[model samples]
Target chain A: MITRVDHIGIACRDLAASIAFYERTYGFSVFHQEVNEQQGVKEAMLRINGTDDGGSTYLQLLEPLHAESPIAKFLERNGEGVHHVAFGTADVVAETEAITGTGVRALYEQPRHGTFGSSINFLHPKDCQGILTELVQSPVHE
Target chain B: MITRVDHIGIACRDLAASIAFYERTYGFSVFHQEVNEQQGVKEAMLRINGTDDGGSTYLQLLEPLHAESPIAKFLERNGEGVHHVAFGTADVVAETEAITGTGVRALYEQPRHGTFGSSINFLHPKDCQGILTELVQSPVHE
Candidate 1:
């Protein structure tokens, strides 16, 4: 089942500039950064000021690396803004079933590789009232 | 300075329907609800799965009550989606000064009344790269 908001994703053409802005203005520091080849974006996760046990609601900024990627399409149409929201889940399989049972389809047949090596699935924005939602099964560090 | 992500504001046409969707799917519960004539919207703040001490990143679902309000105009143009994001701060006045010094503009000359009766101000979407951003000094609740 869905638990907490993991991170809110923002799409930007210039990820470095966006990072500088958050750091300078909001004091958000980059705790994690990764480039997912499959997702076609460079990702940066900003650490917010709650959750002491490595669990916190953070901001994920995505800079499209390819023209045909989903985030690229989003930026082409909407410029730059919130791209999607990710929620934490313990069992993604059960969560996938639960979400699809409500007639909202996941973008993947199953969870795909996501940031921090987590398995994730995206719920179409059209079904979620224009807010693209994602469910993520936290990565096991082993 | 900004601390945590207070909540992500979503513009929806039906507050009840959006609330139901969140409750049924994510198990989020409404922690606060209010109608602010000044903002011309009915707002619902849903508590997420973390933080027991009244500190958690929540979702603020907004339904426009009047046709001429800023949110109504947003819905009329962008359809339904994430409208803005609120960053938490200890002092609204100080934070506002810091943000404005960066060449960004706030929607209000001074922080105005907001959800949960908090002092709040919005940074123009153009300045924030298409994301309408808000700074909120959470209520003391005394």
Candidate 2:
């Protein structure tokens, strides 16, 4: 069900600063950016390399937009680091159901909108060790 | 200097159980397994798709072998989660020096032997926004 690693989500206090560091150190440039009010995060997506086959992974820099945001709480506790690892899939609903049926609890009842027009959902971290896992179904399958 | 994310190191309490979960759920199979006496942990490396280009990423599951091991302390404090993110590079010595030039301290003075004969070194999490970053120069550059 999991096709490839979509992006590694990183929670930071300053989005621009983290972006600057990555760009400066590794020559990675931002490819997309958006604000998700539901998730309460200002996020920037940077592709490591522009590959058409969807083979290249991404670094997702996230900044909390408000104090009550979940990411804000994560930053307060963990400071700034990798927040989650997202896996890419071709079919979100089938993939999500397959994992959840195996006694793994799904974080949401329905799929939600994600970056790059992908459908996304979270798998409970308790089942997957302590790593928060996100399943994303890309709209454009490369 | 980084080319791509090689793998995400996950420190877990039970290597076999964690390996089973990943293999069963995501179809991730173990590509290599070994016990590193230096790190004091039994580790397993799983290739996401068994690709040869090194574009595909990996998951390194680690289980502490001794009470004094660093992974033991990490598991005790943070539970089973990401320990570090390893980035692939062409030159470990040059990449290590470049990152440290920005006042980001290297965790070790010398590169250490890593899985797949890669030369590896770490950047202090304190300097890298709470993320322990590993610079890995794979011997068989794909």
Candidate 3:
């Protein structure tokens, strides 16, 4: 079983520029912004209109802050915009097992730390239908 | 102004296999499925939970039935899972104009035929931050 959308991840070369764009153009407000050194990314969570308290889904803007970061490579090859969609899952291992049983590849052999303190794993885009799928298991509440 | 998520596009290599995975694992039901010869894609709509009926949010699974399809190229470069996130806008023309003014390239200069017959325009991923974005305007009277 799965819950709602956790976050929509976007890879950007400049967080400030993209942040300004969403704020000025769409009125989306940044709820939280942090740098995950482990993941080599600086991310900002922008709440969608009318969901400021994290009650509704949010936009995650990721800026690689480093040269060799995967985000940078992604930008170099694909350019900017929708990177991945993180979905809330009841059980990451079970869901991943289910997916792998179908002979699809999981990005991580096991679960890994995700953006915003969420436990997440990326299902290989090849395993999925061409979209990079993130399986997120959030804290039992919220 | 924006409402909520319109849908996430998933580019699949196999329409039938992806459909079965989403339906069985995620509990999504098919809203609509079709083959668009011009687009070179076979698309299937999966209703994301909590957004049913005229629900604005859903997932569009797209399989490049032809090798020359753009979706096919996306698959070749990026693999699969989540392609783009569509946002529901109050005014498509206004939004398109605003975004275009910001230097974000629109796949089409104007809204065009979309899944489920919605008026939609795609923003070039290059300008937005490595993530593909879509703007959707529903025909249903508000």
Candidate 4:
């Protein structure tokens, strides 16, 4: 159901600083940046390497827009660090249905809009051995 | 200096069970399995996708071999979840020196043996935004 590691989500106290750190330290550059009000995060996607095949992975730096944002809550509890691991899928809805059919719970009843116009949903961390897992389906160009 | 995400290291209480979970749920197959005495863990590398161009990413499941193992310590505090993010590099020694020249501390003075005959070293988590970061250099065939 899953393709590759889509991206690694990191909860950052300061998005700009985190982006700068990765850029200066590792020579990674931001590929995309946007604010997702629904997810309550201002995020920047840093290309890990120079691959434009659309299969390259990214480091997603997320900064909460408000105190009540999920990223804020994660930062409050865990401090600034890796938040979730995302798996790439061709069809997130189908993958969610297949996994949930096996007794794993999906966080959303329907697919939700995600970064880069993707569809995304989370699996319950309890069912995923305490790791927050996200399935991401890239936006269709048609 | 990093080329790509080498792998995501996950600390698991039961290596077999974790490996089974990925295989059954995601159709990911184990590419390699080994007991690294120096690292004090039994680990299995699961290929995240079918791409084998030496750039394919992996999910590394690690279970501690003994109580004193670092994986055991991480499991004690964080439970079964992601442990660290590893970046692939061409020369771990040179990368370490370059990174440390900027005042970031390395966990070791020299590159140490890693899984699959790779040389590896770690950057102090405090310097890495609370995320344990590893640099891995693939062995060269001469």
By DockQ, who's the top model here? 1
Report the lDDT of model 3 for residue B14.
81
lDDT of 1 by residue, A3-41 (tens): 667888999999899999888767789999999989999
Poorly placed runs, candidate 4 (over 4 Å) = A50-54, A140-142, B50-53, B140-142
lDDT per residue (tens digit) for residues B19-129 in model 2: 999988887889889988887989999976423345447889999999999999999999999999888778899999988887789988999988877799999888787
Give every prediction's interface RMSD.
2.8, 3.0, 4.9, 3.2
Alpha carbon lDDT at A69, candidate 1: 82
Full candidate order by lDDT, most accurate first:
4, 2, 1, 3
DockQ of each: 0.57, 0.53, 0.39, 0.54
Q: For candidate 1, lDDT tens digit of each residue in B1-142?
A: 6667788999999999999988877668899999999999999999774442345677999999989977899999999999998888878888889889988898899889988778999998898867899988877421
Best-to-worst order by DockQ is: 1, 4, 2, 3
Residue ranges of candidate 3 with Cα displaced over 4 Å: A49-55, A65-68, A76-81, A90-94, A97-111, B37-40, B51-54, B65-69, B72-82, B140-142
Candidate 2 regions with alpha-carbon error over 4 angstroms: A49-53, B50-55
Residue B108 deviation, candidate 1, in Å? Answer: 1.2
> Interface RMSD for candidate number 2?
3.0
Determine which window of 10 residues in candidate 3 chain B has minimal summed lDDT. B47-56
Q: What does candidate 4 score on TM?
A: 0.95
Arrange candidates, best TM-score first.
4, 2, 1, 3
After superposition, candidate 1 runs with Cα above 4 Å error: A52-54, A140-142, B50-54, B140-142
Best by lDDT: 4
